[model samples]
Target: MTTLEKKGSDGGGSSSQEAAARRGPAGPGRFMGGQGTEKSKDFKGSGKRMLGLLKRERPLLIGVLSLGTFSVAASVAGPKLLGDATNLIVEGSLGKAFAGYSSKAEAVAAQHGKGKGKVADLLSSVDFVPGHGMDYSAIGTVLLWVLVVYLVALVFGVFQGRLAALAINRAVFRLRQDVEAKLSRLPLSYFDKQPRGEVLSRVTNDIDNIGQSMQQTLGQVVNSLLTIVGVLAMMFWISPLLALIALASVPVSVVVAAKMGKRAQPQFIAQWKTTGKLNAHIEEMYTGHALVKVFGRQKEAAEIFRQENEALYASSFKAQFISGIIQPAMMLVGNINYVLVAVVGGLRVASGALSIGDVQAFIQYSRQFSQPLSQVASMANLVQSGVASAERVFELLDAPEQTADPVTPERPDELHGRVAFEDVSFRYDPEKPLIDGLSLKVEPGHTVAIVGPTGAGKTTMVNLLMRFYEVSGGRITLDGVDISAMTREELRSGIGMVLQDTWLFGGTIADNIAYGADGATREQVIEAARAAHVDRFVRTLPDGYDTVLDDEGTGVSAGEKQLITIARAFLAQPSILVLDEATSSVDTRTEVLIQRAMARLRSGRTSFVIAHRLSTIRDADVILVMENGSIVEQGNHDELIAAQGAYHRLYQAQFAQAVAEVD
Candidate 1:
């Protein structure tokens, strides 16, 4: 049984003490300094790569840009048209006040009557207003045209938004698909060093951040930029002096935003890093909740979690606080510009150099100009965050993949299960070799038992055989063919493994049993379950073979889950079988049943049994004792006992322990 099972069954010390013993010292906060703390180094490169992803939908992007341009143009034209209507109304009203004329025609009529005008006198007198000089009809016509322009602008804006949204969604969809594909190609070594939660955050959180930024930032970026330019042109057309005064604030706002963005970028990077770290901690705590509770270490766990949470809060606050300064800073500059324009334009209007309507239009254009600038300034945080996330995603995409075979070789019609490891040397670290110059062979239909203490490199041998990790210095061959030459799928198809840690997906019992054998009939599944003795317990369940297993097979005991995996391997019917501590979790009776089933299952195939319980492999054809990184002794159980070697000592010790327990 595992340490956790022993601790829970025996009732250990206080939960905090148990947790501390299992976890050891905190290691000077090492968790905060590793891969979890890594930040994006090349923001520009990542941003460029992110933008490059959209190139695939160039036509859609072009359509979006064109629509955005037209929409902005129409919207800008509305203010200018409104200005023209205001100017006409003001001019007509002023005429009536100064000259007692209701319209231009009335003024012309009086002049013509005095003989200052010739033949046009009769027409002017007939068209003149009675009391006021203002022509309400002309002003109403101009206002109606302004309303039509505003309505058209609103329609274009709506269509532009729709098209932009569609384009962004399509681009983001393709981006997600590409990231998903990249994940499958990554090597196991990539996952081995990184925390699973951190990797998950990159896949789910980081990608989502990029998508959200694209959705809010893309269309607004294009529209805001266009609006700024269009608004500037209108301002210049109205009055150069006022335009100059408004433009003065542009440089100040730009400088302020640039400095603020620079300060905020590092904070944003730190924020994401801390966020990933916190997620990793939470995932770890959740997965090991049972162990924590069993040990009564909830307080310790909560303390550690609180520390991580505070770190995340600190980083997030700094990032947001720094970025927050941009808006108000830009607003202050905009307000100052507005005040200057009002004062200057007021002077020009009084001197008759500019009309009230032109002043009003210029003021509106100034606000429009400042609005886009403010938006762009505020968007700096989002863009930085997006780029940071993109960089992380790109890092995964750029990781080296497992080497592939140069050629796809055809599988032989028959595999005899003859295996050899020739002068093999392997190591996880280059400076320290774990398996050195090891040579071993197994004949067809022979059983080889491997017995070793923890870290004896026993599992490493199986790993090499299965090609989970390649041999460092030598080759492993199966049926006279180098295993590496064959495709991984083709080579692994003929080998069935039952690991100590049983893995069963969420599915019906029958479905899991049939997992190894595609297109397997119900009869085949039943036969395999019977062979593994899984049918004995499965039949007692309410739904029998149709019963659903939760993820991780939580509803079943460890022993039952192991039996299901055995049944799955049986259904595969591979040429070779490997049982690594297959009965480690079961009771004595269950182990007996499993041993019998495993024996039957291994009858005609070459088998490798890795066992800690010496009694389980006593009847094996040969037994190998491993110590450190090398095999020290090899023989059948009786032979090894007679020889009084390392195997004899191990078997004797276990036998004595079992006898003492019984006594």
Candidate 2:
């Protein structure tokens, strides 16, 4: 068995798995090994948009085009120049073959004495130097010219490639930046609908595909086109008859390419789509490997992975195989053209209509011309695949952004954290209302403890207050000002949130704690750490506050991770606090320290707490018991207990559960 299989069973993850445990900012994360999930690709539209994107590098693109043109033009002159040298050698040799004769007529007279022979007719096209066996000096000069022209072409080609790379890199750089900004503008709810791996594939893999193809195929595409034009022009200049013969293959190449291209395009799209599905599967399984192992689902995970891998292979094979046929098919047409051009040129030379040197040059041009056609046909898969990837990236860029912050926004001169919801209504789906016409007011400097069973919309209420989701109807206000009238940034500025899932990036503990505030000092980080009871455990580690941690906080336990997050929130020192089971993760000793900190943190501040642990809210100034998105009862803990309502039953159930766990 493979190491992965031997160790664990971990199936993949997907948007399907993200059935949304956390509604908004902490959106849904589901497990379904899936990748390359995209809609029908728009090849033409994406190609156009990609072109438009590159237009920003207009001057560089134009420069590359010009250099490629000059380069190809210079290269096309090489065979003809070499042909001149060949003619020089032939003229000198024929001069010796027809020595004691000054002209073709004299040569014909000497050889046939009556008719102009085909050899003599061919010789008639060149002016021979009688008795000069070969003009070595003239041949050398022609070779030098050939060398200079080719060298110049080489220089231009080198610069053209460099400039092409520069332009393409710059364009891709801008594209990445646009994608980054687009992600920021997208609403939190948008992520709930997308698979994490698929989104990642679009942002990273698809964009990378675009960059790679543009770098490798962009300059080559332009150069191949220019080479065809230059070579065709040279072919016609040397011998229009042979040029027409070479042109015979054009319609065939075009027709074949068009047919094969249509077949290949869709396959490329399918290939990328399957890739995304596979990546999502891998990402999910890897992340949830431990769970899979504990459940002995490794065999199941492996089977799913194999299925996705097989799908990817099938798609990739079809795409490559279909596109691969074009190049060889184009080569077949080119070879036929080569034979026709060669035969025709030879006949023209014998007919005295062309010199042997011009026929050779014309034949070379035919080959050169057909070569570009084949080159272009060979690049079909790359072009199709790149455009498919491009469409995915464009889809991301074009996703509808969140509603913009209001212009001429208003905020209170001073915030007292008096928050109120005035008949608010909200639902993730219109058919299923989650919160409807819910109304409440929390006075400044009071702790409101929200207690409820799962799906009671406790978290949803806080999310609305945080403005992660706008209310479908009615308005929420703070300090007599509608929050909608305030920028999200400004409204969130005075609030600190510590969620059930603690997020710690790959950085030092000090930095993670300081992330709560802008440019917090070392002293402030240590103070916050102490308040959250993180300092004691942090000091037990080798590096203490300076100790580094992974994004998952791998070096620490789950409880420690939550403590660090609490410490971060403590440093923020906001006027309002949202703690979502913030104290539940820690040990009993640490919980005591955190409770003391929380008591101090709650003083002179409006706070909302979501807790399943009923004991924690006993000291809250007011306990709001919510059920089905409505406040069934609200009062101090003792008052709610005396009323014998939903809050009382919840407290009893928890007390019983606690007693059972102890037993």
Candidate 3:
């Protein structure tokens, strides 16, 4: 049984003295470790960790890799083709000029000699002129080359587009799955300090940003790196001096990018933190909109949101604006180098130290080098954001929790439902023990009630018993064997709980009730609903149990929702039952109905009821009145009343409140 179960049992109420004994010097009991202390540090290993995450689905990763390579090849080849075609035009034009000169010389010699007659005949025809005025044949040849260039470019464009789409989509899917799994595996304490909005930002906004980064940057980074290397090789091959001039800006540009990246990475981290806070505030305001309106604090809420928004804006502006400076700075340096290379290369070509095509090719390579530098600067921003999100995500996955069950879980043939908490002592924080060195033995087929004040560690007790948190000191046993020795699934499968905060998925009522159970029969479901008094309400719905519900049961009444929860719990029909403030949130009439449903649920199973209403558990087999974190009194209702102790005082106070309400 969990700490929640131990404290919720209304029958096993403890006395004030026992509760005092359990309380720490500061206050009531609380987890084995104190609340708000579980820090997640999962993102520590960058290279190995990322690789491990990918190893599970090697085929999918390999496909992404292959497509990514294809995309890079296409992008680089497409640009190279454009430059190559320009050179072909230069070469083809030069060929036509020489051919025309030779043809003219032949025609002059023929006109002056015996072939003069044939030359005159050719000149008269004019249509037979192969190379004349401005080389029409060369123009025709260049037009054909243009058509081929366009056709090749179109093919590469299509290939690049398809490959990019396929590679990015696969990477995003895999990344999302890994993130989801990490979130699921994290301990519940991860949620204690953070706002729902912040958590949502990590899962939704942060992950989406990472996905977008991966999609755009992955190919660009790889292709740009390759392009830079290729261009440098070509430049050196053309003329070492011109190549040296063209790359004069390389070291300076690299130094600038490195310095900018160093400043930008920290700012990106700050920006994301600000984003999380802003998201948390927005989420809180939306969820509590009703309360804000009732209190007429809309302006106040808006002001709070404005503060968070301003912080987010400031952080983002600084980070992005600074990173944005990198591209233009790189362009300026490239432009200066471009002028230097052009002047040097032009002089060399004029002096016959270099060919015209060589100088032109060197100029092209210089421009090409600038492209990769520009790309690196741009993609650097995305990489920073991805790294930040990766860190936060890893933190979540690294949080500590109870040890996982062994490779092979110990599954019992049957559960006898005998529960015992011996010498149990626990604290949410080590400084404040919620349950002092306490012990209890619950025999099979008995109802146990735990009564306590608000901070008396009722829920904590259930948490411990359920092994949601490991015990700080003490042992819990089920049917004479230690529960710690059993697998979590095996231990929890035999227990059913209906908590006050009921949750329903976006599915038909029948589906939610059946949940993880395999193929629940219609009769069995309806029977369980009837037992829990939810069948009558289900019948009233237009779709009965088939009615689909939105998350949180937006369409259903609160009472009906509670009834459905009860029905679902009853359907499980575990060996032990736990009711955690089940009726506290309902109206008086619904409470009575639910109390009756609880009675039916308690018929055969060993039940733990955590109740606030004294009248409801008057017939409990055992009542343990708890205060702070200890049981101060334990006895039947009549016996505790006769003892004139804490339980008696609580009963009297409730009776007086009932009388006052009636008047």
Lowest lDDT block of 10, candidate 2? 1-10
What value does the lDDT take at residue 512 in candidate 2?
86
- Estimate TM-scores for all models: 0.88, 0.94, 0.82
Instruction: Give the Cα error of residue 651 in candidate 1, in Å.
Output: 1.2
List model 1 lDDT by residue over 115-138, tens digit each: 765333322323234355677788
lDDT of each: 0.79, 0.83, 0.69
Higher-ranked by TM-score: 2 or 3 = 2
**Residue 467 lDDT in model 2?**
74
**Segments of candidate 2 deviating more than 4 angstroms:** 1-40, 112-116
Top model number, lDDT: 2
lDDT of 3 at 23: 32
Of the pair 1 and 3, which is ahead by lDDT? 1
